[model samples]
Target: MALLSPGRLAALHQMGATETRVLQDKPSDSYERGYAEDVDHIIPSPTLFDSLRDQHLVPDDMPAISQCATHLELLEVFHSLRNRVIQSRYLDNAFNIHPSKRIVYHRKHRRQKKVGKELRDTGFEGRREEKWKYYLNIATARFEQWIQGIDTAMNDLEIPPCGRKVLPPLDVLVVWHAFLLNPADFKEYCLKKRLQHVQKIIFPWREIHEAIDSTTWRFTVPADQAGWILQTTLLEPDLLHTLTEDSHINYLARDLLRNLSESRWYNLAANLRQANDRQSAFMQTIHAAINNQIEHRPLVENVQRQCIFVDKMHAHRWIRSPAVQGTLTRAVDKYENFLELFRLYPNKFLVPTLDVDLVWHTHQCSAELYRGFVVDRVGRFINHEDNISRGTLDTGFTSTEEWYQLRFGEQYQVCLCWYCEAILSAVEEEEVKDGGSWEAVDVEEIVERVGEEVEFCRDLEISRQKGRRLPRWKHGAGV
Candidate 1:
């Protein structure tokens, strides 16, 4: 028989069966002169060898076992062959077996067979220690491979120093070899590294300490070794408010001021007068309106608190008279123009578009009461020059197209003026029939109408927010 392959020897060691016997007698011995020990099976028992083979405990190309005198001699001869195949096959098989089974196999078999009768005489404690040592060696080798895998994965990512370097958990290797392999679980292991907590783990403790010691790194202060750091250090609400005020983008502050002004809240009005004496007349008017609308109303009164204040009697009178309606309509147009100016430069003012809309809607509704003033006459004689002029005004490159190019550095333009003009003309004709002058409309009512109109426009804009109508960029297309 051929000598056992290294893989078979290792498998024998793994299965706790290493004893092999071959029949032999010295010719010089008188007692054994006529007798001979017959040749029997060598190395691992047939049952154990079958188990190892079924579990793929040895490499396929390894030779079958042959008679040998000692386990140590067998081990030496086995290791002399290409040990790579043996080591690889052992590791590959070991990973498939349950960690508990591996532990038990080593304890009951490998050491007992290697030391022969001495190990068999030793108690379970001695065997257990031997098993632990065996596992430690295997774990150390496996850990080296685990480290290599981590390094390989990291290199494949090729992330820059400034960019994120995601690291897999060391625990994953422990779990993978200890338990059944799972492809799905492996993917989840990768995702956890990208999160904030795991990202912190990638930095070495020494490097973290060095960063903490640096005076220039201002955001976080180091905590005592035993204590937890508070994340709330940077979340000062008062400081945030101050920053917003300094930046002039405090929308809440603007809204509060607007509401106080529109409702004519006198205490607030007095406070504003003291605080900002250089306030514009427009602001003063808004403040006075807020005071009258909100502060003066009786608590028990059942009247609807109008979102925008308007003179009801004046609105009724305007609705009755065409001349009044025409005047109200013109006032609505002017209010819209003022709103558009502010909308185009929202950042310059602290006011929100919603606030502008609120004011505009109130004014528009008041103007609507004057609809009786509009005339519904259509002229049969058309002036071609007027048509050409109107067409030119509507057709000339749209401001929106020019603005789009300026803002986005793209030449894509969709002519919305055609649609805008149609809407504007319809509103204009309707306004002429209601009332043509601006002064006849109540200022309060116009403000109310303007507010409502702004809200309507805002809603329309939001509905269209997701659609991107811009054309694709072409070569040589410059702004």
Candidate 2:
């Protein structure tokens, strides 16, 4: 039986946490209904498993007991679980689930079209890069404030770590989703900031979606919960007001900072900076800066420096570019090859550049497809380990570069961009100086934290699919 931690149990008892009432949902939209139906149709039958068993595709070490089910049978169970998770987390209208990359790419395209048109309409005199940067600067600054708001909510809720929940605005959720895709950076940022709630808080995605109506893009809080939330947090009681506040943008974060200071929400604005003295001084400086009317460029640069998410957002912009779009198919092909390399040598860890990683992320979004792909091609479940240290990641990347060159007769560095090149060179230089010290470090602590499924001792029997060649790319990726 599972046991709760003493601290958590006490928190739950003190807070009087109640089970959420299951509210009946309204009829789903056409797209949502269709998607749910499609998922339901994918559920496999025992007869299908029997055919696979006859074909020697699955292990048959157990009798037909639910507790002692075959591997294929377990797969069916997990598949059904996944369907339930999707239904509850997504299709049930509890939370606003952001579109996958497939759908999101189109949304991004539309956003770009809007931004470009706005630029033209305003007669902004700048290069294409400058125009895009202008938009990114505003967006990232807004995202930084949104993160602070989330922190405020998390800290205010005096409940167990996992029990505290806040509904993020849809626009904020979009940025947060991108931030999470780079798991290492995201985890490290939260840990470094001592954001325990941010790190451990359970996202009631369906609930958040339901709270925010999809058609109107408006939000509502349950009347019973709203009172407590308003009293405990800095947020407005009416979620519509919070939504409006989130929709507002500030390029230098001047407006947001002023509001925080005015409300005496110094701790939240200071971002959990531990020392009382430091927090006070920081808040004073911010207040003085606002009063003095800080220069635009310096404040913008400062915001950019403090915003850890800007880099990933910038990287995503490049990924969504037409050049990357042209080469996406090639990147997917490379990603398959990367998986095949893992299949060939299961003991070693590998790392992908941003381009290939994008493809890997998209595949994993479709849980069923990802499982099938890895099982058929790699012969085992290839888990994506997100929490990794920089040292470990660099080592894996360097090793992958060498292995890829030897196996594919090609350089592993796909992007010729200055930032990518700098990273590539820095890793190589560090490797030379350290003399492969990373290999000597405790790998389990730093590298990919994989599960017991990784078989290193013996070649496990696999239902390998027929191999095929992917078309070669004439151009480099990660523009």
lDDT of 1 at 343: 45
TM-score of each: 0.13, 0.30
lDDT against true structure, model 1: 0.26
| Tens digits of per-residue lDDT for model 1, 279-320 | 322234333334343322321011112201122221122111
Q: Quick one: best TM-score, which candidate?
A: 2
Please give, for residues 1-479, the per-residue lDDT of candidate 2 as tens digits.
01123443343333221211111111111112222223221211223223222322232221111111122122222232222333332111212222323212223565464322212223212222232223223233344444565566666745432222454433333345445444455566667666655644433333443354321224455665555443443233332233223333111233334343233333445543433443333334334333333322333343333233334423233221222222343555577778878987799999987656655654443233445657887898776655567899999999998888888876566542322222233333445667964444332321121111111000010100011111121122111
- Candidate that would win on lDDT: 2
Error of 2 at 328 (Å): 1.6
CA-lDDT, candidates in order: 0.26, 0.38
Q: Model 1, clash count? A: 52
